[model samples]
Target: MPQSAQLTPEELVEVAQKISELLGGKVKFAVIGGAACSLVRVASDAEYRGTSDLDLVIQPNKSYNAEVISNWLVQKHPKIIRSVEQFGVRIPAIPIYRGKDEYLVEIEIFDVEAWPNRQQYNIADTASNPMTTLTFSPDQYSGSSGDWKIPVMHPVWLLREKILSQYEREGSVKERTDISDLQIMLQVVDPKSLVLSAHNHVTALQNLMAKRPDLINKLRRAIVCYPVFGD
Candidate 1:
C-alpha cells in the first residue's frame, strides 16, 4: 500500500499527541471530521472507517492567528517539513509524517466575532458562538500530550457539524460518509437530547426539523438497517 493511502486510527492518535507536544501544552482545540468519528468509534466501539487527514478548530483570541499555526509547525516540528494549501485554498495545513505514514494536518481558527455574514447558518451561529466551548465527556479520550489539555467535542455537537456539512452539500461523497457517521454516533447518543441541544443553541436544525420533518426518522431507519446489527 502507498504511504499516502488511508490513515489508521492509531496514526491519528499519534499525530494528535505529537501536535500537542509540539505546542508545549499551550494550545487547546477541538478535534473534528472523519478522524474524530474514528476516535469516537474507538471509544464507543462503533463501526470503524479510516480518514486521510486530521481536522482541528482552534478557538482564536486576539493572540492566535490561523496562518501562523502552519508556519509554527514548519519552524517547530521536524516531522512537519512544509505548509500546504487545503483543497487548493490557502487554508493553513502542514504535512505530518508518522514514519511511513503521511497526511495533512489541516487547521482552522474559529472566530465567531468576525464570522462572515454570508456563511452564517443557525448551526454555525451556535458553533461559532465565541462563548460556548465544547465539553468532552468522560467516555472519550482526552488526547493530551504531557501537561497539555485538549478538549473533544460532545457527540451531539460533532453530529451537528456532520449534519450541517451534509445539509450544505446534499449528495456529495463526504455527505454520504457523514450520514454513516451520524448513524453510528446516534446509536450511543439520544437523538432527542441531540435535538434539544440544537434547539437550545438556536441551530438551523429547528428549521430543518420543520422543513424536512422525517430527516431524523430516516436517519433512525438507516441505523436500524445498518449491517452491524441489521434487520
Candidate 2:
C-alpha cells in the first residue's frame, strides 16, 4: 500500500519521537532515505522536501521483544497498522494514517538469520567526509525536538545509498530525482570519496549499471566537475 499524501517535517519528527519513546535507549536505530535527508535539511529546496515514508535501520538489542514493541505501537497509536513483507527476510513496516495524510516507517533489522555474517561499519570509518566524521561515531546519527531524539543516517552513506538507488532505477525520466539528489549531495560532500565508497561495493552497482548503460552517463555527468570519473 502507498500513501496518498506526504508528511511534513514536523509531523515526521512527531512519528519518530513516538517510535524513540517505544525503543527507548535499548534499541538502536539509524534512519536513511529521503526522510533522513529532510530531517537534516541536506537539500534545502522544495523538490527534496515532504518525503512519503521514513526509512530506518533498526539494530535491536539481543533481548529485543518484537511482540511487546508491536503491541505498544498499536496501543499508543491505534492508527498504526503493522505489516511484514519478505524480501529475503521479513521487513516490518508501519504505516500511520490520520485523516487525509499518511506516513510510513520502514525498519531494516540487523543480525538476522538470513544475513548470517553482518558487518557493522561506521560512516566516519568508511566514507571520507571530514566535517562530521572526526567527532561522529557509528550508528549514532540522531535528531531531536525538545526532549525526544531519533537517529538518522550519516550523510556520506546516505549519498552512497542515493547513488546506488539511481543506478538501480531505469529510465532517464524516472530517475531524475535520484540524479538530482546525487548532484545536490556532490555539491556539498566530496564526490571522489563518495564515488570511491560506492566502488567499494562495486559488485552490486556494476550489475545494475550493466543493464542501464545510459545511467552510467548520468552518474558521470553528476560528478563530472569532481576529481573522480564514474569509470
Best by lDDT: 1
Clashing pairs in 2: 141-152
lDDT of each: 0.52, 0.51
Which 10 consecutive positions of candidate 2 have the poorest summed lDDT?
A: 129-138
Enumerate residue pairs that collide in model 1.
Answer: none
TM per candidate:
0.63, 0.57
The local lDDT score (0 to 100) that residue 93 gets in candidate 2 is 55
Q: Looking at candidate 1, what is the lDDT of residue 79?
A: 54
For model 1, the local distance difference test gives 0.52
Instruction: State in Å the error of residue 164, model 2.
Output: 1.4
Write one digit per residue (lDDT tens) for candidate 2, span 1-231: 554347665566665655655666755556556766665552243344556555544443456544444444455555554545546544445666677655456544432222333233232233332222112211232353234456666555656666666666746653656655555554555444444433534643554456556656554543332224434
**What is the lDDT, from 0 to 100, of the residue 208 in candidate 2?**
42
